[model samples]
Target chain A: MDLATVTARLLKLATKVSDEVGSIISNPELDARMDRVPANLGPYGVDPFGFDPEYLKKCMGMVSWIYHNYFRCQVFGVANVPEGRCLLVGNHSGQLPFDAAMVSTAVFLEREPPRFVRSMIERFVPDTPFISTFMARCGQILGTPENCRRVLSNGDAILVFPEGVGGLNKTWRDRYRLQEFGQGFMRLAIETASPIVPVAVIGAEEQAPTFINAKFIGKLFGVPAFPITPTNPLLPVVGLLPYPTRYRIYFGKPLQFTGDANDEDEVILKKVDEVKATMQAMIDDGLAAREHVFW
Target chain B: MRILITGIAGRLGRRVANRLRRNHEVIGIDRRPCPALPTDIVHHRVDIRRRPAEDVFRHAKIDAVIHLGIIHNFRIPAEQLHARNVMGTETLLKYVSKYNVKKLVLLSSGDVYGASAENSQFIDEDVPLMASQRFPEIRALVAVDRMVQSFFWRHHDIETVILRPTFIVGPNVRNAPSKYFRLRVIPTLMGFDPMVQLLHEDDLLRMLDASLKPGLRGVFNLAGTAPVPLSRILKILGKPTIPVPAPIARALLERAWKYRLTSFPAPELDHIRYNTVLDTSRAKEVLGIEPERSLYEILEPFRAEDQADYTD
Candidate 1:
């Protein structure tokens, strides 16, 4: 056989082995997800938000190893994320924001249509070198209302953690209590006429359970807040890794809002409260039902 | 129509001058040394800075002036480059006004829209010129465009059409974008894969020809048919990539560029630093001209050349 043929054969076999490994180590349900990732989708065809599909798949592969193996992520009510454009309003926590990844992966890997939710990122994300492109290429965008509106108007599912960083870096004791949610998501949902699907990600709060909040140290390092997690501040590098806690992601039904995106602040806050309340209830249910953190 | 084509030494200028010579009386002038003309064309060897350059306009009753003599090079200083491009246009504009030339087609680059973090996905021609602020080397285009834009409005008699086209790539193309494609190991900013659009040289030439048609006026963004990420282009070319951090990459590129080892200078690196795709709907609707080939087809020459190299 010619080199091209041989190379193609080798690649096919390699992808097969990888798919098998990905399926074997993770949930059998993920077998299709592993198989669906194309060999090549060019560069920008990977994501409309400028996320590279190949790069995203590679990241998902690594995350799969963690999702299916490390944390053994279990997705619930994933089908509740209705087809077409909708806002995925979820709780953001776990110090490093693994909830966003899990919630997004649940939609990407589990849903029949396999919607790659464009998670709205912070302004600093696109500014950071290398990561900015990866964030964008992986279907993530800055959490601007205009950007969110554009994504939703394009008939694409958008992922947003209404709590912003407040959902993340909360104290160990205050875990699972959703932070003050940002009202921007509600405005976006109303503006774009997109339905809001409340997602409650359990176990993200426990993954990097912090002992203390070191805001001074975080400022010293040019970061927002330095949480003293069990592994962090002590192990440094190893500390970044999340604790192997079982993850359960729940996707709630779509909630429609009829109002102007430029509605009064108090008016928007009421809708924001509704979404936050739904997420809070799901969190309580998941917290009460879970048998153990590690199992 | 007696047409005065500047930058006749340039391959595109020479080809255009030759093509225009078929029907119209052509006056081709340039400072650079050029080979023999095809036929039926008067060649003038003069620098725009000197008085002799305007002698062609004085000598021939020029009806239309195609300003293609913009200095786009890395070797020249920024001031000299600006002086050449801006002053060249000034000299032409003065004569075109003085000579009562009815039509003036000024060639500009789409880079004036600039590759910045905040630019719209597809920048329209109406977007403010931010390219001069981004890079010093790109100021020549910004200044020349501004000059033409003002001249277009200021002079009511002369019908001026400014064409802002993306980087042109075609068979045997040798500018920055083409050179960037030919690099053995293309260095990308470690994390960035900005989108790039390529206008085929033939398509660009055709657009220039179309601009010469009666009643074409105002600024227009001539978009490429297809836009692709920089990484994909390199991947298709089978080039090994070394993703250096932006600062280090900039330093290395500058040195390599200084020594003339690489075609891509530091300033042109901004093109790949951010996505800068121009919106050509205005060109389509107004100019009524569409590129025959997409950016994808424009890279076919490179692919063919690379494949031949592999076989050899």
Candidate 2:
């Protein structure tokens, strides 16, 4: 079998095994870390998964394969990601979640011992058995505020796209301009007292120029939104795969929120805007440096 | 005396500075620092989107303002355009009103009329403005005009005047026609002999000068006396005039836009293709301003300079 087929099959088998054994391997100490935490603090509880170095390596291997064969992405400022609980806030690009994958690779490769991202999974992913099992084993949880707080409090680095679906839905016409961000991540960061590191990813938007999002079709397919691309509809099978695009991942210095966690909503909103502005500048600088959509 | 000019380094700002500097000190603010202007004119670099107008104006002992700063391109997204033009204007107006500025001379556009083939004839100041229906850079001018007018009329202290000029042109023109000139491409002349009306930079300055004088209020069209054929202007610029069908031209333009090869075509081009024209009777009668240079006269000297420079 070719490398891709072998890798895909291995990933499937590994995920199945990990999911079946994950509950048994759960550490009691990690669960007890949340014993004294307020139940009404948020809608979720701390569900910490131990970070296995080998699993992280395997994940990085997958990332390397995808980057070489598909994206050929280059990442920078990977050193800025702290080893402990931190918020990775990045400007969302492309309709697909390629930016997330690139960042995940960067963190894994650049971290001293290599680390895995405590990411938020979409609710729909869990419906598919293989995808859910894989994501769960990988330690990516649902994107609720409660989950974010739990992850951060457990000393795990969490990545959140503050702009949420709006950022992903933006078209080529509105490239680099940030859509309005949700304030939940900011609130979580403030409450957890985690440092927010702004990341900007360029060239993802050009990989598959998602110009339209047909809601009706997306609903029927049980996906978030059906991304309508210029090539995809016309080319079918090959079109679904993102065009190989060079990528630049920039990491801005971490911003600390010194204010009280229970600060007024207006104050938190201002802080959120400040972080958004910093991310926007990074995006603008990234775009200015590159000549083509891919590069 | 302190005066705030939003686009202080712009053509009209320069003219207004020259004309008014003798009496009142003009404080100019723009996105870039203006080191070229005279030392006496205090300049501030600011982005209208984020910077608070109160913070900028509170420092100055400002008396009045000539709010000229705006994104003229209609191809930009509506939010961006609104943020820069509509919101920027509103912020400045609100701040100036709060601080009790003496007067405001708002530079509006003749495109506010929502020009079309039906309104090709001499459109007056009272002509109803059609709502901007185009995507991304829709017409928010009428709303802007109403907002400015209401602020002045309803508010207690501030005085305001609005000058709507048609295709203001001069050496410093950085927009549409100049951009086309820079690209060395003739903009598609959609099979219609549409009359083009333009106000020379000097003439626009003259209108601003009139508005600055006491007792000027309400909207006025500031356009040249006569309109000329767009085809004739294209020929003057040395661009090979190709009469491609409008559909093909649009398709090519769209492709160019996708690749970021060229600036998106202005919504006004749609009106231009359909032979939309503007009336300048108000500018003539009320402001006592007449366009000094015709399109041919303006281009002739530039064309000669260009030929000499290239040959040398």
Candidate 3:
């Protein structure tokens, strides 16, 4: 081989080695030391490292890369995110679940110690090997009521897309529209007496325009989409990459539901609708105020 | 009679305006200016949520309002949908009742049928309005219907006609089944034989003509008699059909719902998946008018346009 070709092959080998090392270092067991909390902070009742701050910082860095490089996100109204145990509800966009990453990064950057968001994980994530381990250690759990209540009671900020899977799965044609939200979050908040903060994230939809979803293949593949999306699913090795687009996180004022905790279902549903309306309005206003649809 | 048509620029609104123009002295009210209508059809530019109802209503000797302006998508934000569809309707109803308008015609969609499996094949005016578990727009419309029903029953001498339409197919639908059909790619079965109900915009106007007839009041399902498959409609357009696996299709739909791809599936995909069909016999019986165009006929105008130019 020529001198240049040999040099290029050596560089490729070096990159592969470094990637493997990085992957090994990111393993949950290797980073178990990050979970250690300092003894001096016991009086404050805050276990700073209880969540593995180093791993969190690394995750935050990854999130920053995704937001800045991939989504080019510009977040605002993060100051409206309450200090503790508040339910953060925002408008979800795109088929892939990147809004959670953006919101998590925003909270991490805004808050001093960076409050961890209790997120809902897909069934597939936990079933996977490496990703499952990292996600579990990083603090994302199933969005069932039991977990939501547990997370809220323990004074952790919970982020939920009340519209659930429907909101994120919206097509390119229905961009910026808030789908019907379920009453679970409202019920959880009322049951736990936690405040609900409405957040509006504008400009995530333009990054990836999903016009049509072919469902039959998605079921066979055990994922939402098997062949479509910006990243080809058949090429699973590189399927996780998201298309870059501008993102803005707009946080609205917190809405506290002080009605009877044991209120009837009708009342709770009404309150849930009200909260959804508030969040929808914030999203509309945010989009309207923007000079361009995409940043 | 002095009438206010909110979406005067729309297909149904223009038809309603055209039908009511000479006899009723109609005053058209729209968010955008319409150059097609005659000058006598009074036009006003105001957002129902942001503009005062009195200011819009006080312009003439307003007798009734045809509320058609709304952001019609299930994936739309609850607040915006509420503000435009629910609050705007509420504001219009409140102002019209306050002004002692004789009647109001509120345009509602058959999507109020939340879950298809729970609903009977034929939904009538008396069918119970159930809240949708998936779509927020339907919930908002349900709220609008409740508000209108309560206000008309208790508050004033005002008469209200709630028209629930099923899959309105025409030239001016701006989006949806129209956009999908224009692209020659509507999700359908292998045989293209899923039953569908549609009403031509012109026939819908004729129904509006009947709605304005003396002493007409009550809810009616305005749709066509026969059901047509989406495949047949695409065949009429002569567009190539691509078969997608159902599971992958649903996942893609869910993804589209997340990203706001197509407006039709976001809030109503579950219902569509279950083949939600509406009974429009009440419209035929009460309105005494049959829609002129069939599903195939509705696709004619766009069929004439080059397929390449129909990009959404």
Instruction: Please name the candidate that would achieve the greatest TM-score relative to the true structure.
Output: 1
Task: List residue ranges in candidate 3 displaced over 4 A.
Answer: A1-295, B35-37, B50-52, B73-76, B189-193, B257-265, B302-312
Clashing pairs in model 2, backbone N/Cα/C closer than 3 A: B78-B136
lDDT of 3: 0.67
Per residue, candidate 1 scores C-alpha lDDT tens digits across B50-116 of 8887677777788899989987885788878878888888888888898789999988888887777
Kindly list the interface RMSD, in angstroms, of each predicted candidate in the order they appear. 3.0, 30.3, 23.5
Give the winner by DockQ. Answer: 1
DockQ, structure candidate 2? 0.00
User: Candidate 1 - CAPRI tier?
Assistant: acceptable
Candidate 3 lDDT, tens digit per residue, B27-135?
7666776887887776777766666546867656788788877656656677877777777887787788777788888877776766443333345677677746656
Query: DockQ score of candidate 3?
Result: 0.01
* DockQ comparison, 1 vs 2, better candidate: 1
Model 3, A172-251: lDDT tens digits are 77888888888888878887889888888887776556656667777886766533555555457565455566778887
* Ten contiguous residues with the weakest lDDT in model 3 chain B: B186-195
Identify the superior model by TM-score, candidate 1 or candidate 2.
1
Candidate 2 lDDT by residue in tens digits, A204-223: 87877877878788899787
